[model samples]
Target: MNRKTLVLPAAAVLLAPLLAACGGAEDGRAIVVGTTDQFIANEDAPAPLDPAFAYDTGTWNILRQTVQTLLHVPRGGGEPVPEAAQSCGFSDKASESYRCKLRSGLTFADGTPVTAEDVKYSIERVLKIKSDNGTAALLAGVDTVEAKGTDEVVFHLKSPDATFPYKLSTPVAGILSKDKYPADKLRDGFDVDGSGPYTMKVEREGEKAARFVFTRNPNYKGDIAPRNEKVELRAFADAGAMGKALESDDIDMMARSLSQKQIRELTETPKERIRVTEVPGLEIRYLGFNTKAPSVKEKAVRQAMAAVVDRGALVNGVYGPTAEPLYSLIPSSITGHATPFYDAYGDSDTARAAKILKDAGVSTPVKVTLNYTTDHYGAETAQEFEALKKQLVASGLFDATTRGAEWSTFRPAQKRGDYAVYGLGWFPDYPDPDNYIAPFLDSDNFLNTPYVNKVVRDQLIPRSRRQADRTAASPVYAQIQKIVAEDVPVLPLWQGKQYVAARDDLTGVEYALNTSSDLLLWELGRGTA
Candidate 1:
């Protein structure tokens, strides 16, 4: 929809400027925001705000603003800083023991004291529950979490992990009140007892309940100060609807759901009306193979398929300039990113791929099933997979069939090995090189792929995590990337740039799009027109 066609009445438009002049807090209106259906769907909704069970970005988006972590990665990104804790540090040079002192007089939204015991309980609960899709995997290094005293918490690790501090900064490690959450099971319902910048204002139900409201938390003890008294998160069916809402000023900002077409249009035509914030790329889209599938069980076949697919064509044709061809699981902006796929497969080499298949005693026109989620990865996903099918069929070495399901069904089916090959996307929990390497390669990885290399899982990853300076550990990650490329468990497709579109009058849009690819709602504020 065009700017002139926006549904907002002229009276409201005129009043908005006057309201901004009077200040955002005086009106007692929530700053409305919108995202795509995939975010608010029954399978993907950020409900049951229990930090221990909350793993998806939708959940983390709200938790990051409403629930405080011991440490937090700053907006532009860098070293972690104290959030709930007054200060935290490694107790020994080996980096095996870590300790943090809780800030004095910390309290949840309900006014219960937040102490070191709550921090310990929050971490212990995650490990104890260990949900299949939960972020507990990120804390695998920790052997135990102990409350040394009323204000002090200590962590004992199974081995040295230099990235442990960064892990604490993630939503998975968000400190929850022991009194609010039970020790044995995930907390029920949408009620949140968080101590971050904002707290839940209203928990609505039924067909009409499409928005979640949050008001400023009076008990927040962190560095973040809420710029608006209230914030509202609204869900939309698709990018077109979200764009229309943005144009009509129905929402103050749109996060993580705008399509490439919408993004490009808003960026070019009405640049003055909306401010678009692009954070450094950290998201990776890749093709995963289920090794148990007979058609792709052979390493040579997998390598040949990788060789036939052109990443350059996929990125430029399907994603436009919104993404870049990624050769490794790690995005190029991050340190230790290696283009091993380029070194091994080069550009689509149909002849070489055919030869490899023939050499492996595999016949021409090998049957393969390619699976993708239509709603999970945005509107371009179907087109992207179609492009892949076209390229693979053009090679004349294999017959590829494409199928799709909505995210809720797609995720579980993929994990259950329902597809021979599938598409997946990853937004890192932390920016460290280990976060990219270890998650996909470890023996018990999130991918559930049969491929596993001991050198990577047992040696390279451990060696890299032990290094105090991540730069010193770069070569190890490079080595791991090369191994991953060679194994072809998953083919790296492209890395995406983060975008947040807000009204021109909204302040702190850039700060809200943090380097971790998380939208920090607390950073947003209204500005005078």
Candidate 2:
């Protein structure tokens, strides 16, 4: 789930034009990172930087790593290990209620001591205001969260949940400094005084505005495998530009999606100078069909689209080996990864797709609109969709029209089923395959599919969520994927291969699906090793 590379000192003298001209070395020490999407300023950054908001990956990486949680993922995969809480377990035998006791001497960035009340407020406040959309869904079964004492917090679950603490460990549930943030809405004020190991110096609205800056938390107390003073994140227009910035040494690292061509260049670069580590990315990319359309609403029409969708061609031509052909809704690394979809639908066959469409009496090509985030993923996304359009039209199956919007408007619009089809990528808020299947596939889910899948809704998702342990949940997840094939809510595209290009001097950084998805910024820069 995590990997480490030799860390280069972020403070290392980077190659500078004038300094190099004089044969003088430059301290290329600042660990500048590059990306295509523009980042909003940190001051204007939305709410608690607390995990409860768990909305965007960019905010999570900045806020999550700086804080300690009651639970966290240890080196290898298993249940979360106690970090802030010295000892924690079920408060009752049924495992419905849970409690945790904090480690002594922990304090916030403001030097005010950390307490169980802070954790209670962090969870309870979000429950009370519910300003943000997804927080309530994440805290679904929670009946109450109470501060039992100065050091202990008790959670009362509406249903028995073995994975409740794991859910709490996600960024959305990140603890805040109860002393600083108001119990109500922070979405407008951008007040993020938390107990994280690092604090934001500046976070702009997006890269086009200015650079995002961070400073080490002076009053922080916690354990980090590798420690560093500060971090800065800068965004660019597309992966092509981000790659160029890295090659030119304008930035020290990058964690955003890269084009297949960019990956080839990053990996093929001499191993001596640049560091490229390919990890199993927890990100899921979807080619979503707007089933709200009368033409696409029919099962046969949806199936035809899936039948003609060439995932292999999409990856090979559009993304290459940097990504793999994904058939199931969940990734193989997940416990509930299912092959049911693949078993039912199989690979693309244009002839079969044509027949399916024809038999359904869809003789006329369906003119559909495809939408995508203009800035989030990368430049190649539009091209990839264009390639898919060519393939679909070459077979005389369907006609496609493409459109774009920035992620802010685009996400809400697609979720509202405003477009005929769209490209969206998901970074799991939590690592469970349930996170994959539960959120996206459920017809009522926020990323709601317009197609109503009775089997998936009534049985599969609920059954998987009810399974006491995750490993026991696979059969239901497999069933969900199979139902997905029959209903064709969205086309499963390619599973991404994550690439992080950081200066060679940075080390001990790894990305996890649930928590921060950070490069473990604490493990970055200015190390003696």
Candidate 3:
């Protein structure tokens, strides 16, 4: 699944003026990458930079570059390959026990030896700390992590999990330096000391800021090689400004933040200087119902809302061709994707939705509030929400009111169950079908809803994950999707297509856009001109 690209020599560090003069590096000069503010992470700030506490995409981008995991998905998009681990496999046929052997002579950035103890400590710390909004769900099946010796670590699972190896490849399973981080609590700082592909250097105009610099990690023992000696991630205020910077040669690449209009415009007008790569992404945008809320507590009310949602119109009207309608929680590219919602509801029929509500003994025109964040999802989100409101109100089964919040406020409030129904987007933590089903449906989910379906959390997901062959688990996933469609705790709105727009001279752009939709910053470099 991973692709390898031709790598060039590290570029010599250039002065500020010369760096901004060209999109590609002059022979042996650094390449500066420009991105929207969304991609930048503040390591110095308290925005959850620690592996145990971090879950956001910006932090994941930084972590993927600066931290090494036991295994990792290749840049070209394939199965998990050994990174820090020299080798890894299930010790038992039931997949109840898994083990890994660390590469010899591995050391942290500070020269401390990385042993199996460090691996055990990292996993234990995550389980012990247990951040409310973090990625603990990824390791739900893990019973214990024990260090057998200096090089060997064993994972004892409560049940068989075929996809356990893929989980270790995520940032959630990033190995940490036992000497640098505390064992009891989460670590906080501007400095990074992990063994990964790159080492970060933070520069701030203020005490706490997002912008920073990354250089190739000399101590890194992984397979990936840095194409540029230094990579500068410059953050702009918005997508429009980021696009302008790319057009004007202020930045070499625009990473994952541009709107549909901007992408189409770049495709049509620029024809020569810029190149865009659109790949099918695993990210899902959905509407989550807070089951605790009075307005959405009834199963019938939730079903009616789901029945009236026009996913086709939402994609074509707001997101354009950059995204497609998603009827199942698992996206189309994944093996278990089945159109249960589409089959059950059938293209936003208002009369059917009205009849469903009336038959449930509910009154006409149920009033409910919809919550969404403007800054987090994208600039196009406001339009998407407005379109959703129109779709619901037009059905005449409900009186929908839409509200907006900035992401900083929105995330905590949504988790607190403040909204009757809310819009949330998910970028996959791993590529497995279990990832789509487990995290959202489990009782102890990130959504913080009062939904506890034993059929899904206890039975279906466990059965599905235990199957080594994902194709064998497809029917179970289809059943899970059908249950989701019936309950309507969340409505699958759309799945996005990944796009990375860079100057034509940039090589390794394909390598950067991996299957997980995470950018491999190290693979991107200037082409010979």
Task: Report each candidate's C-alpha RMSD, comma-separated, in the order given.
Answer: 5.4, 6.0, 5.3
Tens-digit lDDT track of model 1 for 6-75: 1335676555435544445556667877766443334433344577766667667777877889998865
Per-model lDDT: 0.79, 0.66, 0.79
Clashes of 2: 36
**Could you tell me every candidate's TM-score relative to the true structure?**
0.92, 0.86, 0.92
In the predicted model 1, the residue pairs found to clash are: none
lDDT of 2 by residue, 1-529 (tens): 1223323234432422222243211343555666555544333234435455546676666656566677766633457777778778887877778888887888887778888888887888767765433555666667988887788888888767666777776666777775566777664323456666677665455323345565677776554442445566776767777777877888767767567776676666544456676655677687777776775777787787777778888888877876777787787677777665566656778788878878888765766666888888776778777887877777677887678788766766776668777887777766788778756655335465656767776666666766667889877777777777777777778777677766565544333222224445554554322
2 versus 3: better lDDT goes to: 3
lDDT-best of 1 and 2: 1
Cα lDDT tens digits, model 3, 46-152, are 53578887777766777888889999987546679999999999999999999999998888876788899999889988888877774777787899999988999
User: What ranges in model 3 sit over 4 Å off?
Assistant: 1-28, 37-47, 205-208
